[model samples]
Target: MHQIKSKLLLTGAAVIVAFSFGLNANAARMDMVDVSNNNGYMSTAEYVSMRNEFGVKAVTVKISEGGTYKDPYAASNIANVQAAGLYINGYHFARYATKAQAIAEADFAGQTAKAAGLPVGAVLATDVESQEANNQTKTTNDRNNTAFMQEIAKFGYRSDIYTSGSWANNKMTIKGKTGWIASYPYVATGKNWYSTNHAWQWSSTAKFRISYGGFDVSQLNSTYYTADQKSSVKPTDPSAVHQNNQTANKHQQANSSAKWVKESKTYTLKTAVKLRTGASTSSSVITTLPAETTVKTDQAIIQGGYRWVRQPRFSGYGYLATGPANNTLEYVKISVSNTYYTVKSGDSWWSIAQRNGLSMYSLAHQNGKSIYSTIYPGNKLQIN
Candidate 1:
């Protein structure tokens, strides 16, 4: 009887452990879809139909080849996909080394994205395919390719390195913001390419029935935009300038009473407030304000010698200074949390927030910066 009882107890424990493992395995199965046509061969109607029918979440279009700028179709495709409500990102097929060549590719991609009015959702990716016939070029291609991504980041976009799961882990040391792994079945068995990635593309053929070949697979999807995210997607058309101006005026009216603080002691002011060619702070006279200035508890004080205030109410704490503040500071009591994240190459505000289980708004608020705010390796985030 003692032997029988012991046997029964062991059986029960085994069953319980098996059931727990099964549940966890099921939970780890994530649904992901990819929109990649390697040769710039996808049609516009096909792309649009896929987005509409399958609810595809993100699209990766090619912008360069052999370390040189090529293709006009990439811009139109990116625009059409974005207009249809899907997120858009770009990739470069790297096969070159000279810094000039890399910079050219980066500039070309940036110009195309700017023209299309598509804010890159991920870093402008560097796609390294092993089948290319140039072994000598391939030897130095990895380092040159990384340099290309860093150049692109200087243009205010993220850099996501793309390669097979095995190659990226074994051969590449991508120190950009993030890694974009292209492993099918969304599983990394031996050496996962994107071990430190914030997002992963797990499959190629899964579909939302978006015309048989397309599907949407993003973690977050919605039409509503917070003021900060909205500001990043400002209209580029000249005729819409008046409407944009009016909207800007309205935002100013809404946030006119908010306080302004500088992140740096010396900051440049753009003649205009857009991402391109706006005023920047010179190295001179970047100083902090006296403690008696009376900043609101919710407001951000810009440090680093730059003068700009974050408009938390209007733009969700990501908008940089348009100009100086017009009102006296008022303090508000709010609960705050200190958050820590290890910065990877190609990390953006969105990716960091998503990884650490925080909302973009909360992250920006705690750090007192905007969505476009620059963060480097080993930066600590404070969430208020």
Candidate 2:
């Protein structure tokens, strides 16, 4: 599941509105449809068709990618799926190489899901079958996976891991974790081949005699529908779900504003950056602009610990992060001057000189100031 942002996926909205409306936990089998950007913009009709024709009772949508990309269609697809009367869940494409990175990506996934309107208690699985992830040791992967899921728990969501059967068995251990395994069988069997796992992706080209492109289909068991299984792969009572939903709703309402600064300028991405619907990192991602890509911005904003620019779009505008405010690690380069560095808070003369590979005196002399002269944030100093 090394799917990029362009080919991400999602689930239905109605699943959470009334979890018991059309779902039975003790049923022998249930089907779930996972969708993303590759499926194109879906309609409520499509979700209805999925539910009625294919018996898809639940959906697991791709809500975010790595630590920065949020699927732009997630919000719309989630709404449509809900209207079609199917349960909804979420997944994230994992790209973290370290425990810290895993925690950050988990926070990003949690925030993206909440912002996209996924109700609390939804299972937010981490897709951990990326090549870079597989290259690492199993110990490292398991440790990081634990960190990712723990962070997701903090946002009032249950967690799972999505990976191949072989990887789930050998590359990492899901003994204590909820496992959603992917393994296409030679023959179409309603049974989960990986019986020990909670959910089994049985077909990549599944069709229930409906006229549509082949979709990845999976068999979900009773454990998949449980609302509050923080650990273990077994089903549990969801008595605390309502309280969690209320608490999470309060948290979202309190911290959902972005700070804006109107300014028009051209800039270049120093690193790959996600273009989002708003200035916040939790906002839906439109697309990713690779490093060195030049774009024109009509405004700028600071939110979620990073500075972002508002790039005008055909429909409205998209936000791209310039970088974090407290550090010199800028991802987007201001095009005003290539040979200058803008002073940011917490930056000292020596720190600035060190970052520019210059002596403090040399930097001070170039800027026509004493080495001991105090520098302030937003002051541009010549570096070349």
Best by lDDT: 2
lDDT of each: 0.41, 0.64
Give the Cα error of residue 287 in candidate 1, in Å: 63
* lDDT string, candidate 1, 89-144, tens digits: 66676654455666676777666556644463343666653223122244456556
Q: Give me the overall lDDT of model 2.
A: 0.64
For residue 349, what is the lDDT in candidate 1?
A: 70
Q: State the displacement of the C-alpha of residue 339, model 2, in Å, after optimal TM-score superposition.
A: 39
- Misplaced by over 4 Å in model 2 are 1-30, 208-211, 226-384
Model 1: per-residue Cα lDDT at residue 156 = 54
Q: After TM-score superposition, what is the CA distance of residue 300 in candidate 1 from its true location, in Å?
A: 60
